[model samples]
Target: MFEVERHCGPTPRRLRETDLPDLVTLSTAAGWNQIEQDWLRLIRLVPEGCFGVELDGHIVATTTAICYGRDLAWIGMVLTHPAYRRRGLARALMEHALAWLDQQGVEWIGLDATEMGEPLYRSLGFEAEESIERWAAQAPGHIAGEVLPVGFEAELDEQAYGVSRRVLLEHLAAGGSYRIRNVGYALWRPGRLAYALGPCIARTPEAAERLIRACLACRPGENWFWDLLPANVAAVELARHYGFTPRRHLVRMWRPGRAMRPRPRFRNEWIYATAGFEYG
Candidate 1:
């Protein structure tokens, strides 16, 4: 397994399947939404990229990197058990992910950083790109409709995400519903505590609202979550109009001069909501 030297205690190592239980404990303690399956998906997608630090034979810190076909890589799940803080475990795990990604020839590395984590990432050469907010609301009544096939949705996602994430999209859409129109689309899936809406793309604010409204109407009266870029004023307004409140904030940061291409030809205006901070 991957291992790193530490001055104080046991070194961090590659995360294994057996670590799931302790990993869940770490996430739960941090108030994160990741379930076991979420961890499984990341491991299955990039086995060598998941790492954890242990103390007293119990996992205490974790981090993950998921590369999207050498185009870009997303770093997430950075968590440190409260009792294990101030030991630099989080930074060590992050450095491991970065070194691993670089070895794999990854060009762009991106992540959603919390206020508490921003300084570390900035020190590692990541610059803030945009602000993201978590919006929550009560689900609306059911609205009947069939989600379009994955092939159809991927085209729209490609335009908005600026990269091909067919694998990730397929996983997200497996049990989700999508509201699709010629101009936009919105997708939502069940979460541990609420329904999550995201990857919403559209040609205009009105189109985005239509798709979001339809998705919310599908599961009326239940709690819902939506993560959107604050730069999209219309999207923020749409959420506010729907009684959704911003509950959390994160800054999207990326390493400079690392994009494989100058930048993907995508329309930020069409991105009303991102798939999720972890996956993006």
Candidate 2:
């Protein structure tokens, strides 16, 4: 197990599957939108890339890294127990995550930074890329649409994200509905508090709206969450049209010195929402 000593507390170490409950506890305590399944997916996707700080035999802080086939690495789920704040646990885990990604020779590193964490990432040389907004709404009673095959949805996602994320998309599809049309697609799954919609990709604003509406229709009567890129004006308007309101803001940041060919572009106009901040 990887371990790093902190000046103010016990040594931090790599996270294991057994840490899921603790991870969920920490996330819930922080009022974050992650469930045990989400943590498990992170571990299954990048086993050695997650790290945490434990105290009294329980995890008190955490951070995770998701590597996209050595092309791009996303750092997220950075959290610290309320009582552990100001002790540098967040910074320590971040450094460890960065070092591990460096050892793997990842070409690029990125993350969606919360307001409180932006300064730390900036000081570590991460530059701002785009702004992400959290949007929420109540699900409608019903949606009239058809579910598409995973293969089709993956293709649309690849074009909008600028990278193939078949594994991630497949995992999501298995868990929730994959609504698709000739011009767009959307994937949504259950969350602790609401049904989450994301990674929505389309060829036009109208298609994007249709996809989101279809996703909402899949799980009516429940609250829904959508993380959007503000640059997509149509997406923002669509969210509003559907009674979705902005809830939070996150800044997408990236470290330099890595080249991502056809670099992951959101095709903002085509992307109505993201899978989730942690994965993207």
Candidate 3:
């Protein structure tokens, strides 16, 4: 295995496809669910947004920022090799991301922070917003019935996400996606360890359940990951009813720093599931 000194200065740079193997190693080491496609998609989505820090010419730490217009943005994929922890890598990478976002005129930023990472984010001016839960299960299922497709407007999605990111949906729905009669929609995709179902939004619990049931039936007995906000009781109930148990927890944080203006209106009660920690 490659080795490094006890301490190394983090040298920030843009990431490339050639770094795929290293990226996978970092996420796998942390027991994260990202695969090559997930990482590559981000690299392609925002060519200059994926940042990595190298030590002695070897990539050791990384962070990514995606601005969904000037109104809002998200920072994710903050990873550092275990051998290089506590050496100012994460902080440096975070600073780099924030500076870039500021240049893009992004007024609001957010992330799903693990308990281990929460304190660092808080130090950077991110405030707790809500609890994000990852629910999982493996079970066979059959569609309750078919619901005809309907027009899902960008404004409709912004109502739940608080930002318009219609372009992102095309990439996130690569595996398979389904939409119900204007009131609800759900998407499912392949992950490193399992299929992920999420970003589900609906006007009513019944609409949400129908969309969820449709996704569950798509892959019978396969492992699945479902991320949702606990503040939405209907979302919590749907996961439990569909046999998914809580697998992970994260604190959703918004950078309410002095740099930020008043926040947008976010309605999580209508958000049945979040897209992914990386994409959110």
Candidate 4:
């Protein structure tokens, strides 16, 4: 039987290898789903950021902090073993991780909250921004691949990389990180360009909604968005019970720094949990 132990900062155990099975157990126990791929992507892109809590040499809770630079960081993957709840382990691990980022001069820290975690984050100074809403339209019941929606582009083209680069550059230009996770892609023919990430219909609101519907159709359940600011009243209003809510709110508590411009208007229509908060 395992018993609790205190964390030793910056230890080798902090960056141990993790797998989906371990993450699945912890996440399901914690009532968090839909982020397994995000975690998997992070392990590939940046593994050193993943953290775990061990009791009697068994892993229990886990968290990760993705540091973008001296001023930007995102902390996520906060999970605790079901049997270990209410033991202060989650709080302790979070504080340690946030402190480490602070030490690194990460003035801006962000995270998305689960219902159970909202109070904890609120207690720790994470303010309510705006509630997030998810609006999804089921693909045409009888639609065939030959009839892919208009303006529905795939990321599997010669220009795909350049397009992706532009979107990420725009993201960073807006004070957001140039994260490769939120940029959705599709795996088409092995060598052929499969799918595209940024297929925006920036002119009409309905067109924007259709673009999102189109993207969701292309990947089915393979692609998603995370850490988008809740700034769109129309999107929020359209998202009730459609897989969007305050639960989707990308919460943050930073030490204060430079101001960012208002978020992109297009984000109001399409954004799902892609690679967890660490990537955003």
lDDT against the true structure, per candidate, is 0.78, 0.80, 0.82, 0.46
Instruction: Report clashes for each candidate as comma-separated counts.
Output: 3, 2, 0, 9
Better model by lDDT: candidate 2 vs candidate 3? 3
Kindly report which residue pairs in candidate 2 clash with one another: 199-274, 199-275
Q: Is candidate 1 or candidate 2 better by TM-score?
A: 2
TM-score of 1: 0.87
Distance (Å) between predicted and true CA of 110, model 2? 1.2
Each model's TM-score, in the order given? Answer: 0.87, 0.90, 0.92, 0.61
Give lDDT: candidate 2, residue 68. Answer: 72
Weakest lDDT window of 10 consecutive positions for candidate 3: 144-153
- Give residue 208's lDDT in candidate 2 (0 to 100): 75
- lDDT of candidate 2 over 58-175, digit per residue (tens): 8998889887766677888999888777777888889888888888878778899999999889988899998998999887666565455543377777777676778777777755
* Model 3 regions lying over 4 Å from their true place: 1-8, 141-153, 257-260
Measured with C-alpha atoms, the lDDT of residue 117 in candidate 3 is 82
RMSD value for candidate 4: 8.4
User: What tens-digit string does per-residue lDDT give for candidate 1 at 44-136?
Assistant: 767888889877778889988888767688999888888877678888889888988988888888899999789999999999988888989
Best by lDDT: 3
Summarize candidate 3's per-residue lDDT along 1-280 as a digit string, tens digits.
Answer: 4443347645579999998888888898888898888898888888788999867556778999988878788899988888877777888899889998888888889999998788889899889988999999985655454554533436668877778878777677776777875587888888888899877888899988888887787788789999999999999998898788999999999985345577767788888988899777
